[model samples]
Target: MKLLLKNTRTLTENGEFEACDVLIVENMVQTISSFIEIEDVDRIIDCQERLLVPGFIDVHIHLREPGGEHKETIKTGTKAAARGGFTTVCAMPNTNPVPDKLETVQQLLERIKNDALVRVLPYAAITKGLKGEELTNIDQLSKLDIFGFTDDGVGIQAADAMYRAMQLAAQNGKAIVAHCEDNSIVYGGVVHDGAVSKRLDLPGIPSLSESVQIARDVLLAEATGCHYHVCHVSTKESVRVIRDAKKAGIKVTAEVTPHHLLLSEDAIEQDDANFKMNPPLRSKEDQDALLEGLLEGTIDFIATDHAPHSSDEKAQGMLHAPFGIVGLETAFPLLYTYLVKQNKITLKQLVDWLTIKPASIFGLPYGKLAANVVADLTLIDVEREMNIDKHTFYSKGKNTPFHNWNVTGVPVLTICDGEIVYEEDFHV
Candidate 1:
């Protein structure tokens, strides 16, 4: 069936907004012009001058399927992702039976084939069971349809092990997505080591724990000439190191979460676990540096790291709770309201960060709205203001700190592969 979305404002190839109509035939964008002639179209959606952009892609998200379904499953998590205007999400390898072996990767693929609503790409584990001792079968796993290699919940502590992994990835034409943390330096701290930790008398996680490892990985990346991607970068010094590495022509790219760009440790007024996360929120100076890095293109893109834990687990207060919070449901609204509205970055820049940047980095082919491309699109109401309510979330994990925060920019319709996967009924 053919679908025509009419009277929408779209970002052009030159980063300017223009009025246009897009026509999707089957699973490809058939036409995109000011006036698409309606001929035998099965459906016509009046976009009402809303913003139409490429479907957002989140490269780092934990679906927690095959093992930890109590927190979130592929079905529920992909629904949440579609509601947030994401059409594709890369699933982390930290599942029950890690995707280290070919059988494990096939197991994940079978689950995605049966349960996924949006496109789900799984990452194979770098180490066997993510223990950081033995390497996984990267050569065989890369032959499958996996995205890359990562041991997301834990970092690769051994430098020689990481170098071997990078060499393997380089030979197989794949990336090594790293969760850079030297466990020896972490010292059992929960939150960022700063004034907030000092005031609350809580154990603090120092900035060195993140930057020091990043410094190590970039040198390894430069040595191996492999595509090394840093996940959820949260410190100012990390940004500086990444910037210098890029200048020196290292094949290194990094991403920053919205929480790191918007909120600081000062936002942790109480001992709530929702404010707690791995690579915990840093000081205001760190936040400013992250924002600057994003604007200057030092930071490659934005990923939610959308990890969801059970309510019972998060109710244990800040110190006892696990490190993570749900972000697939609120990432776009929060960033659009806070960053774009404040004039820190233009809407086009924000769209590129969420859409094209990550797609380009991961070598995916589904981030543009041009003719002959795959018809993955999202229509957003940028003027709509609503308070975030966790109860209304499609995700099982309602663990979020932005509840009741009034924000503009809601996704009204999401289309993946020319199919209407999600639609918000404004009239109702």
Candidate 2:
């Protein structure tokens, strides 16, 4: 089918255009010109001055399948991704059965292919059952279109095991997404070890707990020559360590969640369990440093850790509750409000981080508007505004702290691989 997207602000690698037209023939971009007079177009979406950028690719997300379906599932989670402008998302392997062995990974791939609305790329577990004691069959899984390998929910606590995993990953030409938390230092700590934790009388998770792990992983990556990716990075000290590692020419990349970029420990004063998440919100100093790193290109990507939990579980006290918030449905809105609207970054920069950069990092082929490239695109109404209603979310989990926040620039349509996966009718 032919799809023509006209009168849109198209974001490309070169730059952003005021108004242009993109012609998608079947599943690839046929033409991208200011004026493309064409007939027989199956769909002509009048973007009406909205931004028409490449569909985003999220490097981190938890599609709680194979278990934890009560929290989320591949079908529900990818629906959330479609609404949030993500055409593709890499799923963490920390599932119920845990995608450790080749069979588990294959099963996940088959399920995603059969059920998901958007592209679902599963990351194979680096260790068997993510136990961190034995390595998984990384090479066999890598041959099956697997995204990469990661023990996402838990970092490999043992250095020797981590190094072996890295060596195996390097040999298989796959990346290792590091969770970057040192469990040895983590002892009953809930939030960031800071003034707010002290004031709230909550257990504090120290910065070194993350930095120490990052420091170790950097050296390991340097030694093994593997592509190392830090997931949901939340500390200034960790940023410095990553910056230094990059300068030394190590293949290291890191991502910061919108929560880390937008909110800080001050929200903990709300004393709401919804504010709880792993690698909890940190200090103003750390937040500023993260923004700086993002601007300076030290930070590789902006991903929403996007973990979801049951409302009942979240309603428990912060100490007893699960750590996470649903993000796939709200990431773009939050970033547009906090980053683009505030003039902190250009829409092009945001698109780059969300689209091109992530695709490049994962070695996927969906982030460019070129002939023969897959037609995965997101259309946004820059002026659209709405109060987030958890009841309307496609995600099963409603654990977001931004439930009532008024947000602007919501996605109007999501197109994946020449299919109209999601479309929002303009309210009359």
Candidate 3:
């Protein structure tokens, strides 16, 4: 079968746009040119000069399946990823009945195989049941097609445990992704330990809670020669430590979430639960450092940290609500509107952070648009504008703070392995 995507445009070397047509045969991109006329094409999509690029990849997302189906499932979550321009997403291992055992891992694999709309690479939990007490059988679990080992919802509280996990993961050639937070330092904080917390009369999660852990793990990573990745870095100090580690030649990479990049504690404005998140929105200074880190290559890439929760849970106000927000449906458009259009960064830089940068760091053979490559692609209509509506999202969780925000650079169509996975307002 032949599929033709015509009148679309590709981003040029100079960050300009160039018109092109992409032809796919089976699951591989056959050719990309200014124009191609072919007979017996099974399908032709008029991209209408929309931007065509390698599908975006988010290495940090919570699919919340195998147990947390009330929040999100594989089918709904992957559809949300596709709609947000992500053709590939890495699922965090923080579900109920976490993927520490091989049997449980197999259950998730089967779910992905049967229900995923796009590519879903899952990670094995680092500790048994994510209790942070006993380490999982990393040697045995690494033999599977898992991306790495992580107990993402909560940080491993014990230094000895993390060091040992890193050693085991390094021996097996797996990355050790971490959620860096010190529960001791956090002290039941809900918002950031900043003016927002002080004025609101609520407990605050200090930067030390996030940064101290990063400092510790980077050292462990260096000693073990492991690829240590920091998830949802939200502090200037966290960026400083990661920056220092990279300078010292430690095998380290870090990701900054769109929420952290776009909003700070100052943006909270009120005691709202939707604005609540782990590694909570920090001071504007910390937010600035995060952008600088991304620009200077200190921060490896962009991830949404797309945690979804029920509306009822989120309605419990700032202190009682779960710490997360739905991100898959609004990430690209939000970033583009806030960062790219504002001229804080170029559009090419944004695309790279979302695609090639993360893929390169993770050693995934994706995030490129080239001949004879798998046809994992997204067509984005940059000129189109729409207000983000939570009710319209494919994700079950409508817990985003960016509701009703106007934005562009939205993904209109997504293809995975030469098959149409998601197309806006159309049946795939």
Which residue pairs in model 2 clash with each other?
Answer: none
What is the TM-score (0 to 1) of candidate 2? 0.97
Models sorted by lDDT, best on top: 1, 3, 2
- Supply the TM-score for candidate 1: 0.99
Q: Which residue segments of model 3 deviate by more than 4 Å?
A: 425-428
User: What value of lDDT does candidate 2 attain over all alpha carbons?
Assistant: 0.88
TM-score leaderboard ranking:
1, 3, 2
Question: Regarding lDDT, does 2 or 3 come out ahead?
Answer: 3
Question: How many clashes (backbone N, Cα, C below 3 Å) per candidate?
Answer: 0, 0, 0
- Score each candidate by Cα lDDT: 0.93, 0.88, 0.93
> What are the per-residue Cα lDDT tens digits for candidate 3 across 25-97?
9999999999999988999988888899999999999999979999999999999998888899999988878
Error of 1 at 211 (Å): 0.6
Those runs of model 2 whose alpha carbons end farther than 4 Å from true positions after fitting are 12-16
Query: What's model 3's TM-score?
Result: 0.98
lDDT at position 377, candidate 3: 96
lDDT, candidate 3, residue 319?
A: 85
Candidate 3 lDDT score at position 154: 92
Each candidate structure's TM-score, on Cα atoms with residue i matched to residue i, is 0.99, 0.97, 0.98
